[model samples]
Each structure stands twice: as structure tokens, then as C-alpha cells.
Target chain A: MSAAEDRLPPLRRSSGSVGRIALIVLGIVLALLLLVAPLAVIFAEAFSKGVAYYARNIVQADTLHAIWLTVLTAIVVVPVNIGFGIAAAWAVTKFRFPGKKLLIALIELPFSVSPIVAGVIYILLYGANGLLGPLLADHDIRLMFAVPGIFLVSLFVTSPFVAREIIPLMQSQGSDDEEAATSLGAGFWQTFFRVTLPNIKWALLYGAVLCNARVMGEFGAVSVVSGNVRGETNTLPLHIELLYHDYNAVGAFAAATTLTVLALVTLGIKTLIEAKGGGDPHRPRH
Target chain B: MAGALTARRVLPGFGPTMGLTLFYLSLVVLLPIVALALKTGEIGLARYLDIITGPRVLASFRVTVTAALLATAINAGIGLLLAWNLVRYDFPGKRLLDALIDLPFALPTAVAGIALTALFAPNGWFGAPLAAMGIKIAYTPLGIAIAMAFTSLPFVVRTVQPVLEDVRPEVEEAAASRGARAWQIFRKVIFPTILPAFIAGCTLAFARCLGEFGAVIFIAGNLPEQTEIAALLIFIRLEEYDYPAAAAIASTVLVAALVVLLLANWLQARSQRHSEKTP
Candidate 1:
């Protein structure tokens, strides 16, 4: 089979070199324009006002706070998602039971939700006129237009990444390893940590990387719940908006450059992990 | 052993883990959706109908749906071309090209919006050149489509790339040996293989475009009846404190999403079955 495949080569290999060259040129140019130029523009604009100005604006208290908030949100959100991802993946994959498919489908609903709709839904559930609004008010509690609200909305949008990555892999791997470990007298946690977790580590990291990228970039729902509280709830993306609106183009683009780097790092890690996974790596999503 | 375990739920913590998953899923996802449904319910059926049928809401829906459809269609073709190039050819920066395709997923939508708006604005890079030709982009519905197209292009490319990679050369050689033309081989052999991924990717792109807010808002000009998207209309209603109106629009989009989600699920299942049949 391998020898026959080698003999055949690929159809494209036999095509005219001129046609191939033209297609390659077009592909490269399009990719550069659509994918690469955006990063260049953000950096160019950021440093247009000079590096000192860009650096100064980036460290401004509110801008720093926005950066901090973005990181903090991801920090909290990623782990919770990691935990939920683990639990859900375990429940559905390791234990095949009634309603298993339904459970999997429901976990995916968060991905289907429009971020703005997530915010709107939260508002209906927690706004002053909402279902639990009165109850929250009675206790002098707040969840909307606050840090907690931002976190919750971020949680809703990002909860799916980790579980979606791990579950399918675990399902395909089956429970043989775990069953083997159990037979060998390992405790449940021991079997899980040694056998299951080690095997799925790359997928877990892959999912976490995507999750971190998203939680940081999340703008739509965060905008609704954040209320654009400068030095407060404004995450990096929202802060970039605030700067742009205030005509601080340099500041806005500078903040945007930071986010661009974050995205680049995420893409880097994602690529590296996928490379490590070697075989057909399961494609993770945004 | 496998049969015995399957028969009796041999796994430990099934109850606890399952409970936590259900509770979290319900609280984080299902409840909010349920609350939106309930909120829309209070507005009597006539008022509910009236809210969605309002001039502003109607206009927003048209812009959103039309722009999304156009974007998905555009991405479907371009994304396939890009994927085909990446998989079938050897080129420098090929890895970079592949990595960069995922930028849309990684980059913040707001950043994407501004980058696109800046690039297409009159004073911006591509904008200045296009302006000489009287081609306006930013602050236009065309700009909205571009942003939607940018954010969604990855879906089609990623989905189709793997399928393309898995298409063995031997399969194509068989057709070639039959004296088939390149185009015919592509149509008969290549196209059918990738069609399912293309459909799957297009659906995701369409669904995503429908909800796209940050990227679209920056470029769309938000010209209420002309350029505003459905998601923006929901945000606007909340800003105006018109809860019922927002919920009404939300109801329409949610219903649409559920349908699309269902369709996507069915497509995925069908594709899985197709692959198993052949492989």
C-alpha cells in the first residue's frame, strides 16, 4: 500500500508548474493581507506616536488596571473552566449512562450562544427587573455591571473549550487504562492522575490555551456587563475601546498591541502543542 | 469486563460528577436562556410580536442575516482555496500561513474591528487606495460583511484542511489513470470528500456571523436602520433599558441559533456516519 501510494504521488504534483505558482502567489498574498496585516497595523499605530508614548500609555493606571482585569478574569475563569471541563468530560466519557448524548449537547449550548445574548440573558436574570434581581437587591448584592457580572458572562462564553477538547479524546481512548490501574490496586485519584491525566495532558493544555485566549479577548458580553468602568471592570479590549473613544488613538493601539501579543503567544502555544500531539490532533475551536 | 462495567455503571463519582456538570451547565447556560424566554413571555403575544416586528428590530435583522449570508458564502469559496493550497502544495511560510489562519480565533474581535475599520477607513492603508476608485468600506454594510468574513474565514479553512490532508493521493491517481481531466477529478473525487466539511464550516461561520458584535460594530457605522446588526440591537435595547424589546429580539435570534445548532449536530452525525461507511 505504501509503495503504491509513493508511486502515485499527488495529482497536484503532476499539474503545471505555472498554474501552481500562480495559485501559491495568490494564496500567500491573500493570507498576508487578511491574516498578517492586522497585527502589523496594530503595532505600527502603537509605535507611531513613538515607543515612549506607547509605553507610557500602556502603563497608565487605568490601562494597567484593564490589563490586570483581563488577566484576573482569565485566571479565575480558566481554572473554573478547567475543573468543569474535567468533571464534565469525566462524567460523560468515563461513564456511559442514560442521557449521555443529551448531556454532551447541552454542554455545547454555551458555544452557540451569542455573547451579546449571554449578556442580555444575564441582565434578564439579574437586572433590577429580573427574576432574581429583587432577591439580590434585598441582600444589597450586585452581579450586573460589576466585576462579578463580567466574570459570570466570561464564564458563560468560555466554559465549553476545555471539556470539548478532552471528552472526545477520552472517549476514543476508552477506560482500559483506568480499569487496568484499578486492577493493579491503584486508588481512583492515583489512576486518574497517573494514567488518565498524563495521557490527556496535551489536549488539556490545548483547551486551556484556547480558553485563555478567548477569556482575554472576550469583548461583546463583557461590554454589556462591564458598563465600561475605567480603572475598574474594563478589560483590555474594552479599555482599547475607551481609549479610542476618548481620542487617545496611541493609547488604544498600544493596548491593542498588548492584546495582539497575547493572541500571538496563544497561537504559538496552540501550534506547539498540536505539533507535540503528533498524530491527527483534534482541532479545538474558539 | 467491558460489557459488565457498561451494564452496571462501574465508574465511581458518576453521581457527583454528573450532578456538578448538570448544575453548572444549567446555571451558566440553560438558566440564562430560560430566563430570556420567560422575560419575553410576560410581554403578551401581541406585544412580543410587535417588539420583534418594530422598524428598528426588523432592519437590524435584515442587515445581520444578509451580511452574514454574504460573508459565509464568500468565506466558503476562499477558505476552500486557501485550504487546498496549504494541503496540496509545498511553499515557504506554509506553517506561518496555517498558523495565521487561526488569528481570527485568537485576536480580540474588538481589535479585529478596529484593525479592519482602520484599514478600510478613508485615511487608512487599503482605504486610501480603494477610495480613489470610489470604493467605500468602513462605516458601510460592506465593512460589516468584511469583519464578519474575517472572523469566520478560519472555520471553513480549519474544517476543510484536515479533510483535504486525509485525502490520499492514491484515490486521486485512480481517477487520473482513468484519463479524467483535473477539473473532473476534483469535481468527482475531491469535491465530494470535502463537501461535508465545507457545509459544516459554512454553518459555523453563518451562526458565528449572526452573533458577531465587536468586530462588526466598529466598522458597521451602526446606522440604525441601515447597518445595525441584530446583536447590536439587543445591546441597544439593554442600554435604553427596554428589557422587553431586547428579549423579543433575543428570542428570535435564540430560536434561530437552536435551529442552526440542531442542523449542525445533524450534519456532524451524518458526516460521521459517512466517514465510517468508507473508512
Candidate 2:
């Protein structure tokens, strides 16, 4: 038995059989309990009230408005963020500049800041009692407690995704393609559209998908600035909170079901992108 | 030569792209941060100290920190196990399991909060069994920790997975051939290689948990002096039109987050150095 064990290659060398089984079982149980159960519960509770009830909740005016608002936010936010991301990636990757590291860190600052703090800073800047409050009030302009406030905070929260995704990718790939195209007498737009864009397209999509998902599901920051009007300013995540608070479990879960599906689709797209050899969107390139 | 080559701009869009990046970064991020600083400064040092040190606020900080620490501890262990399993074992549904690790990141925090609450509430699925044993999860700090753990679970697993995968099997094979015990090999070899990433991941997860609001509030029960978190207190202060108070508390959290981010970056740099030296 000892000789046979020695004859086995190191890769085939087993830890104690009982220990291996125990570790696997523990891993599976933790994943199932911590990660999988919450997901299963969302679908289960969403449909707990039957298809008619779930469907009715889904199309309710408030729910529809919330969904619409979330879509509007995503629609406006994702494109702007994508533009910012591309620009930041371009500057950071292609040029040597002073304060580049600081710039990258600043771009990543929002990811570290609490979303609620994100909401508060904006309110301090633009709320009715804020620094610009009097100036805005004179002109009847509202940024906080309005759609624009929601947009601003959402922008702050998801600002890093696109740039963070593409920067490392662009850095690793180097500026060779862009430089080559430029040296070949290609204009900026032509090189970007034909060369730089193709190389970073998947990463850009990955970033955009993540950005859109966060915008739709954003709760902490949006909750602060939205003013929580039921059918008016509420986004999907806010709508779910409203329903849950009102003891409308079915309604809340139904709304949650929509966001959950969005989350799943985002994950699916992310996995597909990874399979297509898009760089891992989150890791720093060593 | 390399520095000179890099110094010469090779791309024409630098002027346009760099201009846009700075302009947007300022308008969206820096200006608000400056506004926050101004608000906090206007509140004066005494008032800022008083508000942040009030009993309720302090209590909430304790709860937030304690729960976050607990959650980070849980994540480090489970995340390591899962990362190790995924990298080493040939299990059925491995691909699916790998995908599931990121569910926390992709799912909305509010959705996660409610779903976790439903599962762990006393009358709910997991809660019922545990309740029969006289232990409660939801509506307690334990619940808050669970929410934190759920939201931050991917940090450790994702951070450690690549490092573990990079641990050449040949090294392990050599050790095994030399009759090193499995535990000894792991402790002496694999553990050192993955330590920096693991610690960095935990720090990040801890930082994230400290600021976690949406996923935590639903399950936290939001009781003052017991279950309330610092982030919710900031919201409460804001709701009451106490802008100065909210700003003060938020400043503290913000400073802590920045400190944590700096630490994480340093650790990551160190990890990179370690990998480079070893390779």
C-alpha cells in the first residue's frame, strides 16, 4: 500500500480521504447556504403568490414607473459612463503624464466610498439647503430630490466600472495598435473606431453591462436622493423597498424578480465575455 | 530610453481624451468631495466630534465594526476553501459554481437584502431550524454579519483564486515526493504564496462591509443602540434635515474608506512584488 501510494504521481496524491470529503462537503454547503439560497429564495418568493398575482404586481402602475425610471437612469448613465471610461482608458494607457496614478486612484474612489455617503455629498452640493440651494432656488432649479439627483448619484456610484475594466487591458495590450494606426496616417477617429475599439470592445461591453446593472439596482445612494415618491421618482430597487415596507411582500418580491433577472443576465453576459477572452474586468494587471 | 520613448505621445487623441477625463472626474467626483469637506469644515471641530461621539452613533459604529470583522473572518475561511476547491478539484457543476461566486456583485444590494432577510427571518427557511435551537440570525448583529458576508463573499474567492492557480503543481509534486505531509506542504508553501492576496481581500471585504447599507439594513432590524449601523445613522440624520450631523458622520466613514483603500493598494503592490520575485 505504501509503495503504491509512493508510485502515484504528486498530482494524484490524496490528502486523507476523510479530510477531502469533509472539505468538499463544507465548501458545497457554504456555497449553497450563503450564495445559492438567497438567489433561490428571490425566485421562490416572487412566485409564491401564483402567476396571476406576480404578473399583476409586475404591471402595476407604480411598479411600471419604477421600472421605467430605472431604465431611464441606465439609459442615460451607461452611455455617459462608457464615454468617460473610454476617454480615461485612452489617456491613462497611451500617454505618460503627471498625476496619472493619482488620476486612476481618484477614478476608483467612488468604489470605496459608501453609496450613502455618495448620496450625502451630492445633497450637500445641490440639495434645497445645500451650498447651491439659494442659487438654484432663485432659478427654480432642482438637482437633489429630483431625477437629476438620482442621475448624479448613480453616475458617481458606477463611474469606475468602464475605466477600471479597460485600463489594465489597454495597458497590457500596450499602445502599439493605436500608435501603428496613427503612424500609418490614420486619423484619431479612424484609428479608434477601427483599431482601438475592436481590441477593447468586449471589455467595454463588460463594463457597460456591469454599469447598467448597478444603475438599475442601485439602492443606497438613489434612496437618499429620490425622495421616495411612490409612482414618481422611485427606481426598481426603491420600489421593492417601498413595497416591502408597506407589507406588500408579493409586490416587493415581484419587483425584486425583475432586478434578479437583470442580475442573472448580467452574470451570463459577464461569463460569456470572459469565455471570449475579454480580460477579467475587476483585477489589476500585474 | 524606455522612459523617453513612453514620454513621447504616440496617440493623437490624448489632448481630447485627457481633457474629457479630467473635466468629468472633477464635475462628478472631486467637486462633491470638496463640497463634503466644506460642509464638515463649516460644522467646526467641536460639533463634529460631539455628533460622531454621541452614544447612538458610537454604538452603531461598534456594531458595524464588530459585525464587519465577523463577516470578514467568515469570508476569509469560506472563500479560501471554495477557491481551493475550484482550482484543485474536478467537480461536477464547477463552471456553474464559479459563475455563482459573482452573484453577490451582480445582484442589487436591496434585492440581496430582502432575499437574505426572507431566508433568515425567524419564520423563514434557515431561520426556522436555527430558531428551534434557540438561536436567532435575522434581526440581530449576526444577521447583519450574514448580510455583510453575503455581499462581500466574492472578494476573497476572486482575489485568491488566481494566486492559487498560479501555484505550480510541480512544486507541490516535488514536496509530495519528498514525503511532506499535505498539511505541512500547505502551511509552508501554498499559504505563504496566497497570504498577501488573502489579507488584501479581507481588508477590502471589511472596508466594504463597514459601508454596506442596503444589504444590511433589511436584516438589521434597524434598532437604535443595538442593531443600527453607521451608514443608516447618516441617512437618519439626513432625513431629519440634520445636514451638519450627516456630513460629520459621513466624513468619518469616508476617511476610513480612503485609509482602507490606500492599505489595499499597498498590499496589492506588495503581492505583485512577491509574485515577481518568486517567478
Candidate 3:
């Protein structure tokens, strides 16, 4: 018998197969218990009273404001990173550069740095006694413990996503298309807008999706910088914490459920994108 | 060809690229790092050492490293098994299982923390059963480890999955033809091939655990010199307005992370070289 057949004999024999099937079933059950069941509990608890309770708690002014702040932060952070991503990818993949390795490493620094550390760095740079703090104070400027501080920390944490996504796509596609465009008399801007952008468009979208998810979900960095001011600086994640601590579990779970739903939707979208992008013959060539 | 050649030459190749790269690095990465170093310097080397090597800092480091290492080790085995099952098996709910693996990547850390804490608290459904066995999870180091493991599991699973899929089944069949037992074939053939990817995944998971804060903070109970992690310690220092001390602690963490990253890259490169030579 083939090795595959030999391995299957135990399965074919109902008596000996019981143990193996049981083991496989146990593994699946454990994973479900650990990962899925808890989420089910959270959702059930949130909606236990009714949709009215969820709607009322989730639509409260503070919760609404936190969600709005989170969306605003995503708006501010995603675009800046996308721009930085385009620039960095253009520079790294399109050119043979000195200090290229160093630049790549620097771009990835945020990935390695703790989000809490990112918050700390911003505070050191913009807090009242910070290096830029006195100069800002002279100008009556406030960066920390405010909206800008939240945005800044979000920026630091999510900066690497777009660049990382674009770099590999650009590298594999090469510079031939751009050169051909330029030869065909397309100007730099035109070449970029026409050839380069179209090619990296999918990657750019994927990166932006990832960046948006992270910025909205961020907690540690924003927590340190925002000072958790009730309605002023609180983001959704922080709002959940505040409500939970206040024994407002329903409100907290309502906010949590909203974020969770958003996350699940993003995951679904990402899966579809990956499936479409995977092994497709339509990818743009060098 | 002539136009392409001139474009290559006149397009301001390495020089401009290097200049932009350095400028960007200096602005966004190096400057902040330099500021951290200088702040630490202001406290003098002795004081910096004192703060970083203090009892609380030392305890945090020990706990963080211990928990991270244990979690990564556990993940390396379970992640590889899961990858193997996903790639080789034709099971029911396979699609659902595949999608579930990425949940940690998308779930907000704070929400995850809350969910985990609710499930593992003494009164929590899961925790209550375990608590009956006299094992405490919530507000303890075990809870920290579980949270880290939960968040970091995807890194290992995803990293190893693609590699396993690429490992053609024919090789395993060949080993079997050579009279190797199933376990033997796995150890001698499949294990070596997938080992590097597993290690890479473990390293990524370890680095993540080292820096994990959001989920851990909720469950770790944040006791000084006990449940406190390095990230929490840094946060506490910053909250107290102890910039110098915070910078000192952060620098130490940064240096440790750099070392792990270097080791990971080195292992990856070595594995690639081996594969290239063999093929």
C-alpha cells in the first residue's frame, strides 16, 4: 500500500479511527472555544436587553463623540501615510539609492517600536516641558493632551503600513513601464499619474485599509497622549475603557461591538482582496 | 535602448535616492531616537543604569521575556500543526477556520483585552472552571501570557502557512518510499524545511509580545514589580513626568528589540541560502 493509504487505514477502520477523529474534533472545538465563543458572549450580552438598549447606549453623546474622533483620526492619518508611502516607494524601488537599507529599516521602525513608546516620544517632543513645548507655548500652541497629539501618535503607529505594501509591489513591477512612458514623451507627473499609480493602486488600497483599521483600533499610544479626557480627547477604545471602569458594561460593550463589527467587515474585505489578488494572471508587469 | 540607458544614467540614480532616504530617516526615525538617547544622557550614565537596572525594571524585563518566550515556544508548535492541518487536510469548516486565524490581526487590542479579561476573570465562564483547579489567570502573569499569545498567534500561523503550502507533497511521498516512518519523514524532511519559517514567525511573535501593551494592561493588573511589563513601566514613568527615566527604559527595550530583529533576519538569510544551495 502507498504511504497515504497506510496512513488512512486507521481512518478506514472505524474502531481505531475513533481516537483520531476525536482528536481532530477536540482541536476544532478548542479553537472555537478560545477564539469564537468569547466574541459570541460579548455580542449576546450587548444585545441581551434588546436592540433599543444597544442603540441608546451606543448613540449616547460621549460614545458618538468617541466614534467621530476615531473616524477623524483615521481620516487624518491614512492620507498622510499614503502620501509618505508613495514617496518612499517611489524613492526606494524606482531608484538604486545609498543608505537604502537604512531608510527601509527606518520606515519599519514604527513596526518594532511599542505603540506606548510612540506615545512617549510624542510627549517628549510636544509635552509642556518637552523640547518643542516651550517654543509652542510661546506661540500658545498645544499639541499634547489634545486632538493633534492623538493624530500624531496615530501617524507614528500607522506610518509603515502603506509603505510596506507598496514597496514590494513596485519592486516586482520594476521601472520599465515608467521609462517607456517617459520615452513616449510623457512628463514625470503624467507618467506617475498614468503608469505608476494604476499599477500600485490595489496595493495602495490594501495598505490604506490596513492603516485605517490600525488607526481606529489604536489605544496604547493615543491613551498616553490624549490624557483620556472624557469628551475632549477620548477615542472609542479609550471610551470603552472609561465606561467599563465606570461599571457601565452595557455602554462599553455597545462601543466594543461597533468596533468589532467594523473589524470583522474589514477582515472580510481583506480576505476578498487577497483571494482576488492571489495567483491572478492580470497583475501588471514590469 | 539608448533612451533607456541615458534614463538610467541621468535619472539621478543612487545619489538622489540616497539623499532622500537619509533625509527621511533622519527626520522621522533617527531624530526621535537621538532625542531619546540625549535625554537618557542628561541623567548621566550612572543614573541611567540605575533606572534601567532597578528592581522594578529588572522584574518587568524578566517577566516580559519569560512570558514572551514561553508563548512563542507554544505558538511555534501549535502554529505549525495548525498550518499543517490547514494546508493538508480536507476538513469541514476549513474556510471558517482559515478566516478565524486572521481575527487577531483585525481585532482592536483594547477590545480583545476586554473580551479576554471577561472570559478569564475568576467569575468568567472559562476561568471559573480553571479556577476550580486552583489556577488563577486574570490579573496575573498567566493572563498576560494568554493575551500575548492570542494577539501574536496569527503572525506565526500566517508566516508558516504559505511556506507549508509551497512544500510539495511529492517530497514527503519520496521520503515514505525510502521506508521512512511518518514521524521520521516529518522530522527529517518536513521539519527542517519549515523550521526557518517557524523561527521567523516565532521571532515576530516574540517581538510583538515584548512590545504588547493594550490587551496586557487590562489583564495584567499593573502591579509594580509584579505584573508590570516593560511597556507599562515606560507608561508609568512617562505619566509621572520622569522623562529621563522613561527614555532610559525605552532605550533598553529598543536595544533588546534590535538584537532580536538582527537574529531573526540572520536566521532567515541563512535558511534562504541553504534552500538555494540545495535546489
Model 1 sits at a Cα RMSD from the real structure of 2.5
- Give fnat, all candidates: 0.66, 0.74, 0.34
Error of 2 at A194 (Å): 0.7
Q: Sort the candidates on DockQ, descending order.
A: 1, 2, 3
The alpha-carbon lDDT assigned to residue A34 of candidate 1 equals 88
lDDT of 3 by residue, A201-221 (tens): 777887788788999999888
**Which predicted model would earn the best DockQ?**
1
The true-versus-predicted C-alpha distance at residue B109 of model 2, in Å, is 0.5
Candidate 1 lDDT, A116-234, residue by residue in tens: 99899999999888989999999999999999999999999999999999988898899988876776778767878999999899989988888899999999999988888889889
Question: Model 3: how far is B84 from its true place, Å?
Answer: 1.0
Write model 3 residue lDDT over B1-279, tens digit each, in one string: 566455362232345445655575565566666666667678898998889889999999998998898878877766776776677666788777877777777789999888888888998878899999999999998889988988887877777776666666667767766777656876888788878978878898898889888888888888887899999999888889888888888888877887887777787777667667655
Candidate 3 has what TM-score?
0.92
What TM-score does chain A of model 3 get? 0.89
RMSD of 2: 2.5
Clashes of each: 0, 0, 0
